[model samples]
Target: MKRRKVPLRMCISCKEMKPKKELLRIVKNSEGKINIDLNGKLPGRGAYICHNPQCLEKAIKHKLFERIFQQKVDKEIYVRLTDILTENDEDI
Candidate 1:
């Protein structure tokens, strides 16, 4: 038997280190499209956020995506992220 290593990621909003699987990923693809990477396998530059709404709101309020992606983020992207986060919360 072998011990498995857990991948850790930092939440951009909360600045907390958590297991990768527990964080939501957002990616900026090669074509410069920003999207929520629900599968966490999207090919692009990625930023991590916690599953909590407070973290999401903090990220949006601070415009962390703009700093992460180095460009302006569309309002729809935030809306979509919020929708997805809330939807996932309901399942918990």
Candidate 2:
């Protein structure tokens, strides 16, 4: 039997390529809704980020979401991302 290949995605913060399952996804939907995508199956444009809080901060500090999505990110979205990060940390 042959093993399947794993998909990879690049983190917008640290810019490292990692397995897709390990990265958190953020999506901009067609209706202009932006949110954290835990399932990684949402439609529209998507960007990847590491679960690490530092990477989240760097992305926020540099306005990376704006650059990639070409729209302003809501403060609430950042808050939600931070909350998710904390939850992820607690799991470890």
Query: Could you tell me every candidate's TM-score relative to the true structure?
Result: 0.92, 0.94
Model 1 alpha-carbon drift over 4 Å, by segment: none
* Candidate 2 lDDT tens digits, 35-64: 889998899899999988999999999999
Scored against the true structure, residue 7 in model 2 reaches a CA lDDT of 93
**Count of clashes in candidate 1:** 0
lDDT per residue for candidate 1 within 1-92, as digits (tens), equals: 99999999999998999999999999999999998899999999999999988899999999999999999999999999899889878989
Best candidate per TM-score, number? 2
Residue 9 in candidate 2 has what lDDT? 98
Model 1 — which ten-residue stretch has the worst lDDT?
83-92
Q: Name the TM-score of candidate 1.
A: 0.92
lDDT of 1 at 34: 93
TM-score of 2: 0.94
